[model samples]
Target: MGLGKTLQTISLLGYLHEFRGITGPHMVVAPKSTLGNWMKEIRRFCPVLRTVKLLGNQDERKHIREDLLVAGKFDVCVTSFEMAIKEKTALRRFSWRYVIIDEAHRIKNENSLLSKTMRLYHANYRLLITGTPLQMTRLLDILEDYLMFRAYQYCHIDGNTGGEERDAKIEAFNQPGSSKFIFLLSTRVGGLGINLATVDIVILYDSDWNPQVDLQAQHRAHRIGQKKEVQVFCFCTEYPIEEKVIERAYKKLPFDALVIQQGRLAEQKTVNKDVLLQMVRFGAEMVFSSKDNTLTD
Candidate 1:
């Protein structure tokens, strides 16, 4: 999960600033919880870049805009998803170089107002970053995969009984391809679209367990029409979960699916104290054995 997506975004911004010489204004839309982190990362990586945290009432938003546009004081504007939705009208007033969506999975539900607002914005580049992008749950005896997986049921129709004067109502809405704004780069979302082909690189972090999450995340960059071969960097670790995840990802099993099923299984089962104690004891033994080997002359 700590694969430096934010750092990559900062690097991209730096490239746009130095090589392209196109630094007008940039916006980073992320979760409220992470807006501070984004600001911190920006300050640390690109200290020269001016950043203004946009949050508060209408007047506050207006003030921020004035400070940015009129004074030309800030280079990047960081705002939360809620504020983005509230102040979309004001946000759209300025011409932005790049509009980045961190934790872009918040827009998974295209019907939501947040999604609508994000789609309405005009920016040169749109980047989406997240660790988990799909929601899969079981209800009423069916396995349903929403969004990225391409399985969605909009409505149900009733049949006419014996042709007795009856009219059927129709319900419709745009599918996944409705708004073609988001370009996903994640270890949680899976697959890529046929027409979608603009990702440059996908970095994968190493783990102890089967990396179903990382594999699915890589697909977001490697779908059909991708101009270049997706460069995947797996940062392997010594953690047990990381190791197992990497092994499973190599085996080609959907990481999220395994996590979901296993989560459900754990929820439905009861914990075994003796078995857990034995496993803990085994871990302790391994740790002590390693220490003993290191101490010997």
Candidate 2:
């Protein structure tokens, strides 16, 4: 998961600042646990950009807004998805150049208020960053497609269509002058949607384990509408857990089974005891295995 998504986000922000001359108020929405991580990344990469973290209660939000509006004071604003939903009214008041959604999968549920709130806001540019873009279900695919390309009408061509037919349709739709509605940086989720004529670039990172994960990751960028010859970058390190997970997924094992196997392997390798114990506890909970089954015991 340490795929430099944060660094890429910072680079995009820097590009906007330097190339596009976009110094307007910008916002980044991420999970609560990652707000500090984002701030750290921004400071490390783009120190010149001013930032305000939206946290605390009503008064805190007011203060954040006041500080942001001050003439030439702050350039960017960062907040958690929770806060963004809570303070949607206040957030909409400020005109934003870019609204970046980190772990955009959080809003994969199209019906969630978080997704609704995000869609309501007006931003000159919207960027979504995530390692696992299609975590929940195929519904996520639709939502992300809409968000990235603003696709108004989307429907499966046919469930029984052969790969050749599917490719032909995608090719036709992705032809030049079709629509400039969507740009995708997906992994497996984009395989069915990848248009070589439309996709600009793709970057692949190596970790260890799952074929499904690997397949999905590649499909994200290797799609049909990609007009330019795709550029793919693969990154790998000694840590092989990610690769292991991918391999297991390819074997058709349930994710839970793979996790248990991984845990056992880690324990065999003398991995952290606490982490192992945590995995054991997790497994016990999954099977509802308990030391004290009786309510009073």
Of candidate 1, the 10-residue stretch with the lowest lDDT total is: 165-174
The CA lDDT of each predicted structure is: 0.60, 0.65
TM-score of 1: 0.47
lDDT assessment of candidate 2: 0.65
Best by TM-score: 2
Which residue segments of model 2 deviate by more than 4 Å?
Answer: 69-71, 135-297
- lDDT (Cα, 0-100) at 159 in candidate 1: 26
Query: Residue 50 of model 2: what lDDT?
Result: 86
lDDT of 2 by residue, 2-36 (tens): 98888877887888788988776888999999989
What RMSD does each model have against the real structure? 14.9, 15.2
Error of 1 at 139 (Å): 24
lDDT of 1 by residue, 1-297 (tens): 697789989988888788888675898998898888988998999887788899878787777767654437778889998989887777887778889998877787889998889889888778887767342211111222233356443221112112222112110111333332232222222332222345445444323233445545566556565667666555545543554444444443333444566776576585467745564454344334553222111
